[model samples]
Structures are given as structure tokens and as C-alpha cells.
Target: MRALCWTGVNETSVETVDDPKILNDPDVIVKVRLTTTCGSDLHLLGGYIPTMRAGDVLGHEFMGEVVEVGSAVQKHQVGDRVVVCSFIACGQCWYCSQELYSLCDNGNPNPALTETMWGSAIGGCFAYSHALGGFAGSHAEYIRVPYADHGAFPIPDGVSDLSALFASDAAPTGWTGADLAGITPGDTVAVWGAGGVGQMAARAAMLLGAEQVIVIDRLPERLEQAHQHIGAETLDYTKDSVVAELKERTGGRGPDVCIEAVGMEAHGTGPQYLYDQIKQQLRLQSDRPTALREAIYACRKGGSLFALGVFGGLVDKFPFGAIMNKGMTVRGAQQHGHRYIPRILQHLADGELSTEHLATHVMPLEEGPRAYQMFKDKKDGCVRAVFQPNGASSTSY
Candidate 1:
């Protein structure tokens, strides 16, 4: 099998790899149909996230057909179309029982690394890093899905493959932020970064009945998509004062909820951004929290803030003072897609969610390297470069 592999820092290639087989009684083999590059993949590509070895397969968000089933996998069988969650979880853990699927105790098999780094390990994600179980990613023709009954959801009949693909990660991630950040009806919400996650977060806020939802970014193309597809207001941070404009738009109160979807590689104007970049490159900090800081400062006092972005490790100049003085609620988590994917799929089936527009570039598995370059550079207005590992046709299923 040919799969996309992370060759080195800022490098990727298509390489021949062994095909996956069912490894456990609870596992199944999925023939990937569509898999897409995610912003979080940039962290691994740039060497920000440690433990990513050369030749590690790269991808997580995907939808596919079940090719082979395991003995214990009852919910699915051969030929079933399913979208697997990015996070791998075992259904019987205490965390899974509590609906915190991403924090499932049995998820990450290689837990010592992350346990040492963050005190405790969270969950495993496909091809995220060695620290997250080292599972082969979905950027290939076949992927082994562990805990198939818990981690994969059936795509509803009316939802297209393109629409269901995002339910694997991006959309559920947005729902995680909005649902956990305590979004209330008639509240004003602001999301930083107009990428797929940010746009999805804005859409989630709107569906949650937020009176006003705003998405901020420097890209004209993403902002336009936010307006047209997500039906949210957009702000070009490069052209206007984000904090001031947000305050003005929200009647001097600022946004009731502020979500930061731009993670480690956040780009911004000013000395702070340069400082972050230099520090990150110098190995002084593992992440750039430029948009996160802005989101905190932009949220109204007593408002809620959610960090939906992926951050690997420590960051400098975190504003603990503002959080203390403003009485703000701050929360962050990986997407617990198992808890939300069913509803998201229903939304897609009902024609209430729009995700196909996020797939700006669709190519074959052979174009994996070029696709990652374009996606990482944000070139040609590429939001997400979708890879059809098995081919573009869905008729085979």
C-alpha cells in the first residue's frame, strides 16, 4: 500500500507501506475513501510536536467503507460506510462512560510519553504522534480502526461522503468548543481563525442560538466562506482592530464567548508575533499562542473562552492576570467526537451543516506531498486538500 508519510521536519512523501490487518477482536479494517489534511497536522510537519518519527503515516480526519470486521465488532460489517473519530477511545473506560471519550483511559497505548509530559495521557489519535499510540493514519487505502463500535459512526443515507468526512474531526471539534464553552441562546460569540475548525465553530454557535457570531481571520477567502457558507460575520484582523471592532459590534460588551481555533503556528502582526516565532524556532517554546491571547483579551468580563486549537506544550506570556481579574471561564480539550458525531451526522443529513465547501482541493493519494505543502502554506486559498486514497469514485462501496 502507498501512504503519505512524514519524512522529516517540513517534509512528506508518498511511500509504499504494509497493508493493515485487524489486530484485535474489537478492531476493523476500513478502506479509506476520503481523507483530508488538518491544521493540526502542521504541528507535526514543523517538528513542534515531538516523537513524530520519519515515515510515520499522516492523517486522521476521514470517512471510509468497512472492508473487514473483527469478531467483537457488532455495529458494523463489510461495506458499511463510516466516519471514524480522530480520537481513539475504548467504550468501557470511566472517561468514556462519562461521555469524555477523548479522555478515555484505554485510548493511548503508548501513554508513558504524554503522561510524563502532561502529568497524565489523554487519548490516542490516528497518526498524531508516537506519544498518541502510533497508529497508522488514514492517508492510505486501508486503515485499522480500533474499538470500531465506539469510535466509528455510520454516515446517514442523505449525507454525501464529502459532508460526512468532516464529522470525523473538524465539525465535532467545533461542537466540542461551542458545547463545552457554555454557549447560550442569544449570546454573542466570536471565533478566531476562519479555517475549517473556526468556521465550524462559528456555525455551531449559530446553531446553538447565539444571536451574533463573528469569525476573524486575515485571509479574504476564508472570511468570504464564513459569510457565504457559515452565515457568520467576519473580521479581517489585518485591516481592523479585532478587539475594538468586536467591542463595537457587541455594543461595547465584547463577545460573550470567544473561541480560538488557530493553534501553535498562529500568524499575526507586531513584535509579539515575531517574538513567538523566534522563540518557537529556537526551541524556547513549543507553541505560539498569539490568537489565544487575543481571544482572552477580546472576551467580555465573565464571559467564556474555549481553546479549540491544538497545542503541543508550553507557551510563554500567558495572561493569567486577565483570567483572574475578569472572572472568565477557560476550557480546552481535544474533540470528543463519539459524544457529538451522531448529532453532527444528523445535521449533515438534514441539510443543516455545510462542510463540502471546506474541501477546496481534492486530489489523489499520489499528490499527498504537494497537497500538504499547499495546505501548510495556505496557498491558492486552499482550505483543506482532500485525498482520495482508493480513488474518487464512491460507486464501489
Candidate 2:
């Protein structure tokens, strides 16, 4: 087998690797058909995630066909096409019983936890390294699906793999963010960042019945995608002070709900002191915190602020005061992927939710480097790219 292996900061490539087989009766093997580089993958490339290591398989968002099934995998069998959940979790865990699958006590792709819970440590889903259980990722020819009954969802017969690809991650992640924001019919929502995740969040807000969705980002192409295809009002952050501007547009208070779609690799000019305080010493390098700052500042009193973006470090000057003073509710979570995958795909299959417009490019998995470059530089028409494994056929819309 061959896979896109992590090779330290700013490096990766397709390389030969050993084949994987079922480790548990609940497990199944997936022949990867399509995959993509998520923003979190970039964090690994930039060395922002300390747990990632060389030889680790990369990629989490994927769609594939079941090649083999463990003894207990009764619901799935050879040739069954499925979309993988972003994380592997036991459906029977205490957390999963409560719908908190991402934090499942026995859930994995995390080594220490796996060792603690299962009496030993083993790998998890592909590409996410040690901190995440070092599972071989979807950026490969094939990957092992642990907790198969829980982690793999059957793709409907006519649904495009391309369209359902995002149902695995972005679509559900955005769904989680909107749910946390407590959005209601006619609520005014404001979202930050216009990445694949952010654009999806904006669309989800609309589907949830938001009367107004204003998306903020500097990328014209992304903003245009939001405005034109997504039906959300767009704001170019580079052109103005987004915080002040959002408040003005919202009538002196602020938006009813604010979603931070940007995460730890967020960048800004600094005196070195600021960067050191927020990034180096504490380890959170994502700009989502800064967007959180804006969210707190711009959210209407008694409203909500949801940090859907990943936050990796302790903060020095976070807006604790505003959150306390404004009486705003704040909540967020890693996508409980298994919990949402089915319903989100139902939306996809029905044409109620379409991310086809968001996927701007597609190519062979061998083109990983070129795709990374396009995303890092925010190339126009490069909002998202899907990786089609050689000799594998899967449509991600």
C-alpha cells in the first residue's frame, strides 16, 4: 500500500506502507476512494500540532468502500461504500450514550487514552498522529475502520461521493457550530473566516433558519462564494475593522450568534511579545481565539458565541471580562461525527445541502503538494480540493 506520510514541518509525500487489517470484531477495512486535506492537516504541515510525527498517515475527511469486515461487523460487508466519521468511537461508551462521541472515554486516535482505557495503546484513523492515536489516515490507498458499526456510514446509492465527502467533516462541523450558537428562526448570525469549514457553517446557519448570515473573511473568492452561491452576506476583513463594522451593521448591539470558523494557525503581525504570549508559551497558534475575541465583542448581550474552531493553547489576554459581563453563552465541541453523519447525508441526498460549489479543484492523490500550496497561498478558485486516489473511484461532489 502507499500513503501520504508526514515528514516533519512543511513536508509530506506518497510512500509505500504496510497493509492494515481488522484489529477488533467491530473493525472493518476501507479501500479509500476519495479524500482531502483539511485545515487541520495544514496545522500538521506547519508543525503547529506537536503530536504529529514523521511517517504518520494524514487526512481525516474521506469516502471509501469496505474491503473486509471483522467478525462482528454484521451490518457492513465487502463492497459496501461508506463515509468515515472524523473520529473513531465506541458507540456504547458513556459519552457516546449522551451524544458526546468525540470525547468518548474509550474513543481513540489518542494513545494515552487508548492505553488507559483498553489496557494498551494502538493506532487510530489515518494521518492524525500520536495525540490522536496515530491511525493510518484516509490520505492513502486504504485505511482500517475501527468501531466499524459506529464510525462508518453507508453512502446512499445515488448520492455523489463528492457531495457526501463533506458530510463526513465540514458539513457536520458547521452543523455542530450552528447548534451551539442556539440559532433560531429569523436570528441574525455572523460567522468569521470563509474557509471550507466556514463556508459550510454559513450555509448551515441559513438552513437552520437564520434570517441574516454575514460572513467575514479577506479572501474575495471565498467571500464571493458565500455571497453568490451560499446566500450569506459577505464581508472582506482586509478592507475594514470587522468588529466595529459588524456591530454597526447590526444596530449598535451585535449579531445574535457568532461562529468562529478559523482555528489555531491564524496569523497576525506582532511585536514578538504578542506572538510569544499567545502562541509559543501556551501553544495555541490558531487565530480562532482572536476571532473569539471579536465574537465576544460583537455578539449581542444575552446572545451566544460559539468557538467551533480548534483552540490549542492557554491564553494570556482572553476576553473573560466580556463573556462574564455580557451574559452571553459560549460553547463548542469537536464534531460528534457519527452523531451527525447520517442526518447531514440525508440533507445532501435530498439536495437541501450542496457543497459542490465549495469544492474548487480535484486531482490524483499524487498531487498533494500542489494542493497544499494552493490552499496555503489561498489561490483564487481554490477554496477546496478533493484527492482522488489512483485506481480508486469515489465522487466527493
TM-score of each: 0.99, 0.91
**Model 1, residue 115: displacement in angstroms?**
1.1
TM-score of model 2 relative to the true fold? 0.91
**Candidate No. with top TM-score:** 1
| Candidate 1 stretches greater than 4 Å from native | 395-397
lDDT tens readout by residue for model 1, 36-132? 9999999999998889999999999999999999999999999999999999999998999999988989999999999999999999999999999
State the displacement of the C-alpha of residue 334, model 2, in Å, after optimal TM-score superposition: 0.6
Clashing pairs in 1: none
